[model samples]
Target: METVNVAELVERLGSDEDAVRKMAVFKLQGNIGDPSFADIFIAEGGLVRLRYLTLHASGNTLAYSLTSFSRLLDVDKGWECVDQELVERIVELIVTHPLVNILRGAMSILVSIVSHPYTGNRTSQINNFGFRALKPAIAIYPQFLEMLVSRLSSADHALCANALQLINSLMRDSITHDPEAEWPKFIQKLQDLGVIRAVYVLMQDSALQDLAHPLLEFQSLTKVLLRKWRDIPVNQEKPEHRRALKGIYLASNPEKNPDEATENGDDTRRSRRHHPEKWRRLGFETESPAGEFYEVGFLGMMDLADYVRSHGDEFQNMLLEHSTKPSRQRCPIARASLAVTSILYEHFEVEKSDMDDTKTYLISESRAGFDKLFQPLLLHWTRLHVAGLQAFFRLWKATAAEEEDLDKLIELVRILIESVVGGAARIKDVQDVEEELADFEYHRLRGLQMELLELTYEDAWGQHLRQVREELHHEALQFVKEQRIRSLLQGSWFALDSHSRSEPGPVQKSTATYQYAQLSHNRRYLHFGQFDLMGDRPPELDTLPEKISNVSVNPDHSSTATLKTAPRQPTTKITIHGYAPSTATGHGKGHSHARSGSRTTQKEVVLLTLRPSSHSIASEWLDGLLMLLNQQPITAETSKLIDLVSNYGLKIRLLNVRFDDATFAGEAPQVPARDGLDEDYYYDVFGGA
Candidate 1:
């Protein structure tokens, strides 16, 4: 309202940063509703500038533009003074501007122009420039396009990409109801005029493939365009097709991780979300934002069917098998990768007949041969996942990384848990940390604390977790295996019996084993009375048996394996240290005091002390234990002995061994000689040792 105040505000606008100036402009902008002061700057010789920006541009015009555009696009109250003409002029200047620093900001301003609801009263060429206008710019100015393309060839990869994207925007198309519209006729004319091939060559220039997510992205643009338009054929792979396949490969495999925080079974198609303006700028021709998605629907299936028909069913089936059961033989992530690509390959099958003819569609069996096809990619993903998981755990543990690195941690979670284990119906926390770490409690405890940290402990401790997660890596593999078999059964793709398909080696069936009351010859994987642990063990030797139980020794059962006869070595009698039973089953077994062998006759026991908790359960062996402890105990200890310490809620029993059944205890074709370990002293030393 006051001239002095306006001049003061204008002067202050040039100080420091544009953000402060933007606020002044924003505040002053409201005062213009009466239209007393003009919107333009009056310069010398009657020259007019649309707006005076000298006060705001302190060698940071881009930053200033960002501030200006932000207020112009504010959802609540957009600046009516900012018209589409000003936005378009700004965009044009940004692209051709000498300073590249302002490009992103200029792009933002253009985005604000269309996206900003306040351009209600504006008129500009951009109102009609939508997607359709951007698709055929080469015909309008081929030499200009060529010059820009050449200049971009020397630029950095990202800059080249941006140039391509901007070029696409310049030539993009907009929606129109009439098929016979002037623009459509113009495009057809461009095609008729031989501009299509030449322009296609220009766009396919190898230098800027990443600019748009084109089918051309898969390989160098030059190769792709040359393959399509050149006279000499290279018989090369189609870049666009591969890029589409790769895109499908990456997106469809959203992990069903038990370790994730999101709800499972929600829509798995979130990756498809796109912006219409971006679609317009990228020159997408179809109704969908990504024309590739539509093209894949129509052509992807047909191509795959032809592939399977050429490769044959046997080969296809082999691909699926390699993925599912790759134990020492199979790779886990390799299987997942094949499954990812396979499912995605089927997703866009537009015609049922097209799908049926291709054995690669839908059936899990198609994934078997993917070890070869997928190994390199799988290895890359595996390395990435491992690095990510390790970093995530580190961050989680408050170790090398920090809680502030959650964006990376969450990204890792998305990849590992959400994408890999998507079908986990439920999840629970892993609470048996103590049990799982029985062998190395202290070291494992430290690791556990570090990993569990302040992150996700409640979720980890909850129930149904294991069910959702257990053998996930294994079970998903099985699902993939069965899926392949299902595919073979469909004559639509690879008919199992089809002669036209590959002639495969006969499917190898595992020999079924039979063990019966009378027959023994049928056992294939085992030999007479032999057993081994699935994993490695410390060398087990027949050393003296260690007394593990709290129960006192039974002196009368004098077999060599169970005997505790030794010249009394008066060692300090320390109570054996041990862990609580890790499982309900181990707890239910109570004090584990029986002699080493399943049979009654055993000799030589290593002395052990029990924890206070398990002492009562071993009362039967107290007298023998006390006898073994002493070189001599009063030998009046009797045959059927019992004692009750009524005040302490205690009972005791003592038994002496009988040499009479020693022969029977050592029977052939009988039970195992030991329960805990090869040495009799194994139990006593387990935790305490």
Candidate 2:
């Protein structure tokens, strides 16, 4: 490789020739990682040149220039060459950039510039190399956040996509560095800017397919926001009150920050005790019973109500429009609405003072939003059963059961049952990974159903709600069972577990502490990655088929045996090579009996022996494996370790639940399929087969 001169590249940044400027940036990116080169670049005022180029350059030239700046951000001293003004300019450029690549590059640079290096509440890391230089750049954090949130209203898909990605990157990195402790203020700033509203608006964009970035980030961000208010215990003593008051005083009066307040004199300390009640009245006593009354859910509900008061009609119209479209073409605005309403309703608690204005406001707004957003789904219930049910369940959970809300809900349930019986049900097997994630309705519905089953409502209308739930539960069970059978027929593996082999032979057993399982796509095979103790880098060990035979359940069968224990009596065992008793031979002292010379031997292999954390999880894996193996021959070509099944005795204890602990019950009752999940929905929408 030819080395380029730094001085020459810096001068070429202002070149009229686009190619020359682009080449200069490309060369500068190479030197950014070298401290000596970084020193030379800064000394020669490289940052000034890059900033100038960023504003003037177009296309690839601009992208490369931003890339060079981004790489420079890795150097501690490199940040000193830039300032908050420059950071703000980068954010502005991100929003104004017409090209997606340029916008992405600008965001990439900003993420590096503002990346927090400290984890948790520890402020000691502020002396670290990057942190010192980042002191000034840190001032632009809120500005960058605000710009990203504002861009969601953009018409350009590319711009919106990059904005979402950058925002997610910033948030995810911030949380990793200092989650709930240091990032709450930033989250509050976002909430004040109507982030939830922006999220809903962006979700309705039909052209945007990369929604996971924003959706997951927003969910995570919302949790962090709600936590600050939710975790404050209600009511506390004077000492606790004093501490909260001091903290609040410092926060509100920045000049009297803790350090300054302590430095000022003993009088500051004396004053804190004197005015504890002052801050308490201002809602500082988070742990006090009186403080506990400040439920964040109520606040969230009020915010949402206010939103509905202003945009309720727009939301209703959007819902109506999308409900009329086919599943594939339909934008998933319903989910966005559900996310907002559910969050509001989830925290909404009924107070004895029903006549209180705040209480009345919540009820009226929630009822209005619920009726508008939810009623359409019922009208279109046959085609959108799962999503409709999920939305209905969540809203119902949040309801205070005022006369109007309850009456509407009862009527909606009646309509849902009538719709289900009208024969609008449809189910499609996910053919590929993309189709599997095409919609989250099925997964959401499954979660909602589980939640409903666990909830015990004591209200007068609870019986009616339970009746509807029971019917839905029965249907869900049946649908899940059918899907599993269909998946097995197609050789789909729902999940997989990983473990280390202590001794590989006929007497196989899995023994290791750090066991983490991952979900397998298409269910064709389970690839057990090499077990690593530190969990830094894991390599693949083997890929086994999704087949099993002779599975055993908890001795109690009523409970679950975790993978952590060595069953004193051998709990939850499976036989890979069950055979005629004549051919059965003992492998070792503690090992299960294996078939010797196979005389009518079942070829299915016991690939792993897992003791899941819960009985439900164990049964889930057992049934999923058995269903996949049903009526299918275990041939050598079907699995790599087919021949070793009897000899290797693959035994792995299930250590933990993978795939977000969302398990599909083996014998679930049939329910209507969530329409948008299947590929056929898309094919029909696009006018295909």
RMSD of 1: 28.3
lDDT digits (tens) for residues 340-449 of candidate 1: 22332232121222322223422343333221111111112222233323323333434333324434434333333322222211121112211221222333444333
What are the Cα lDDT values of the candidates? 0.31, 0.44
The per-prediction CA RMSD against the true structure, in angstroms, equals: 28.3, 28.9
Q: What is the lDDT of residue 447 in candidate 2?
A: 41
lDDT of 2 by residue, 1-689 (tens): 57768888788876888888888887877777787888888788777888787666777887888777766665644555455556656756754556666776787665555443532222333433222333344464536456677777777665666566566555555554652455555555666776655665554434334443444345444445444444444333545444543443343332332322434466775655554333322222222324333443323323333333444444344344434444333333322222333333232221212123333333455433222221111112112333333444444434433323543544443333333322222122112211222232434544443343334221323564455444444444444444444433332112223322553433234444433333345554333322225344433223331222232211222233333234333354322333222234432111123445443454333344444443334444445455445432222222222323311221110111121112343665555798567555332211111
List the lowest-lDDT window of 10 residues for candidate 1: 646-655
Model number with the top TM-score: 2
> Candidate 2: misplaced stretches above 4 Å?
1-11, 14-19, 26-63, 74-77, 92-102, 118-147, 155-158, 165-189, 192-194, 201-211, 235-689
